[model samples]
Target chain A: MIYQTVIGLEVHLQLSTKTKAFCGCIIDFGRAPNTCVCPICLGFPGTLPVYNKEALNSAIKVALAFNCQIQEHTKFDRKNYFYPDLPKNYQISQYDLPLSRNGYLYIYRDNKPKRIGITRIHLEEDAGKLIHEDGQSLVDFNRAGIPLIEIVSEPDLFSPQEAFDYLTNLKSIIEYLDVSDCDMEKGSLRCDANISLRKAGSLELGVKTELKNMNSFKGVKDALSFEVGRQAELLDRGGDMVQETRLWDAEKGVTVSMRTKEGAKDYRYFPDPDLTRFHINQDMIERLRLKLPELPQEKLQRFMKEYSLSEYDAKILVSSKEDARFSEECIRIYPGKDKKLMVNWLIGPLLSEANSRKVKISELNITNDELISLIGFVERGEISGLSAKGVLSQMIDSGKSARELIIESNLLQVSDTEELSKIIESVILENTKSVDDFRSGKTNALMFLVGQVMKKSSGKANPKIVGQLLSRRLTDA
Target chain B: MAIDNETIRHVAHLARIDLQAKELERLHVQLHEILGFIDKISNLNIEDVLPASHILPISNVLREDIPHTSLTPERALENAPSKKGNFFSVPKIIE
Candidate 1:
């Protein structure tokens, strides 16, 4: 029997505000243990916590970008728990009424737009870090009270691939909004998944399990894939799933049950007395809406229509904000409107160069002017496209201009008729067999003669011009 | 729903507090009375009244985005029950 999988994600994105959510401590990562702490974040007595306006504004910007409905009146609540990392023994979070709700994130699957409903986007403070040493644990409160936005998506994703696509799309929008870096490695953006399996076309949902410890998008997809198979096998054996929280042991590649059904905790949530309700007005929402940049979807559509590119090419260009910016900048400076060429370079060679260098495409040292100039050399017949690739490698290494590299390395294409004729004469004199074969009605021999000429010219001769001159000379001979 | 002994025990466990059987019995009774008062409010016929998250009419209580000097390591760890080289030491958690 076939089964269908359902997946939902909750991503916690640390806002890039200058200071902590409540206190005025500067937000710095990888600081010396807990030196950024203050009385307010340390949860000392007689210290009243105040909300940060920048955090709220950032949260509203993200909510509007996702098309969420902002709640006019929302308040913070205390999520009570007993963790060594939490000095206050409770987290300041939104329980019943969150800041926003009822939104959607659109992801393209199989060339069609799929909408995944966003349940809510709530603001909360981050917890501290716990480092375990030999026989003891260290608590660092520097990260405590940092502003975080929890984006919860509805259970609309039906496959692990769709879930991955949804996450990629979500991260793209977050990056474009300039709210957070969304770096998974630095722990700025973290994700947890809820997945279950049921019979195809079943009305009621199946027993779901919460998965944790997935650090990257690939890890999330792999964990979901593993869970889907596990649940399907249990159902085949006439067994049922138990409700619990499972930890994704990424190294071992399996989900281990961290707690069983009885492990569910009653948070006993109540309104935080310290923070007052937030009354979001229509004017505030409109102002934030205007601040929302052209998100990934809008930019993707515009790139396709304006550049006259295929959806596949446009999607690749707009997937990352940096790549999209590079493409647009190169096009703006290029003398000709060859968007396809720019798309090919940005998505093809430039991406490969970045990967080989183990850096982001935006971190590539080649400037837009250098790239445009390199492409211009090819368009102007100064260098063959093949020769330009060599020049590009040197340009990337030395951070020199394309023209500088071409002239320094003598990589100019041999398009001059008088100069190329000498190289062609020598190639014909040596390759007598191929010349005879070409006269005997073998067209493939003519290409061999052209290759010989290019080799003699040290690959500087333009192959197109070489082919034309070789055909004429062979016919005359 | 009425507050029960099982709920009280679970809540105490979540709060990380150890409670005796006699104490649990006393707390269950006290919670029932408190919840009873709250239940009475729930039974009132105020359908048109907007649910208020806070009693005060104040909203948008916020602070500006500015950085201030933080406490030094000495004062930051002053009240810690256990300390080791500028960090608060706690019992080792395996997970």
Candidate 2:
């Protein structure tokens, strides 16, 4: 139908503090369900919810990391709804004045950064979990009263891939800030995407459906793709669309209408009487802003400039905080001048090992010392490049040192000039034409002779040593 | 300052209060009188005055992020009408 898709995302991040937001109850997930409840969190009468200070710090850090404007005067509101998930009949969330607003996060689209606008970030208390059993539902109050921050984005994305990239970059920023657990499988990080389609050139927006329950980033992307097609077909048939909430069924790969959205008035949002308004001071904002580390974009640029890595390699390294930390450590501690050697090992052999093991590079448990020493084996020509690859594979599997594995497997390179010269002399007799070419100043022929020696030595001859010896033999004779 | 039956019924529904027809009729008049008394202030022009929900002029009350011992599960579920395995059982409200 040639309609441009308008997408905005709202991400709910659980603050990684030790306790619940309003109370001092331990927020230990999966600790026998209701064990974490207390009078404040359970909504017992005469109880007041106290704001968690650490949560404020984390939220301010995240907002600052994304370049948000921290509001000086903000307040919480009561969103009234009758649901079992919320132990209290109403949830304490923000209404008009939130903690921060007007932030922008940069996402790479078409090899250039597209600045996605962040509408606002507000702190709220999470609800409990309701498990629907045979007929009735069971509620666990453990998760209730946990601190959560709602990050609302502007409708800046146009496609499903753009939404996915936005989410990926957002998660990376969250990890760099180290605020939340940032795990989707565990529900620590959750996202709700609102997407609408309008005529290609029309300025007005179409009725957008709010999508929820996407378990992963890929699930969100897939659900959006499905929604795009579904909406386009309905529009093509000139059918009317309604604003509603839909749940993404990952198993069925379709979005089912959950409920027609009730207008905001239905919630009857009012200023929360129990919790008073917060006057966010400039000092707190400046402190949190100072606490923000080098975010993904700046770190990506620095990785390229400082380490001489390509834009592609730098992005891969800085995609996750773990990857960036590991690569940065290895680069910092690397004995050689060329940091690409360390980066190549990180993005190449170690990356393949991580993929096979189904983990991130940081989780592979190979310390930077171990990785650098393994790379050093290749740099010193103690192990041939081909055999070094084998040693690296076993190093991760067996958790052994590169020297130990090389010695045990007898895979050391023939770097000894005396031993390599014999193979070099035999190769010279075999390739007399290339030898004459080298004598005639065809220096490229030297590389061919090194390859011949390496082939004779069963790929064990270090090419560097063979070249040195071959040059000495041809010229000194 | 007028109160209608539909407005009274919606408000009652939102508050989860069961109101009889006779009570509804009585409240329709009673609520009108209540609003009429409060609406008398509308005649006074107070544009410069800032609206305040709470009389106190304080904000930013917060607590440290340290955890304390939580209540035992038995005490937590003690007031529940129905319980199942440390959970409060209720009618299903799934969408």
Query: Candidate 1, residue B34: CA error in Å?
Result: 5.6
Which residue pairs collide in model 2, if any? Answer: none
For model 2 chain B, where is the 10-residue window of minimal lDDT? B51-60
Task: Give Cα-based local distance difference scores for all models.
Answer: 0.89, 0.89
User: What is the alpha-carbon RMSD of candidate 2 to the true structure?
Assistant: 3.3
lDDT by residue (B12-94, candidate 1, tens digit) is: 77767799989998999899999999999878999999977778878788999999999998999988999889899998987
Candidate 1 TM-score to native: 0.95
What tens digits encode model 2's per-residue C-alpha lDDT throughout B1-95?
A: 78789989988888789999899989988999999999988998989988764557878889999998899999999999999988999987763
C-alpha positional error of residue B24 in candidate 2 after TM-score superposition, expressed in Å: 2.1
Model 2: residue A327 alpha-carbon error in angstroms: 1.5
Clashes per model (N, Cα, C within 3 A): 0, 0
Off by over 4 Å in 1: A260-263, B1-8, B21-51
Docking class of 1: medium
What is candidate 2's lDDT per residue for A133-210, written digit by digit as tens?
Answer: 887899999999999999999999999999999999999999999988899999999999999999999999999999
DockQ of each: 0.79, 0.74
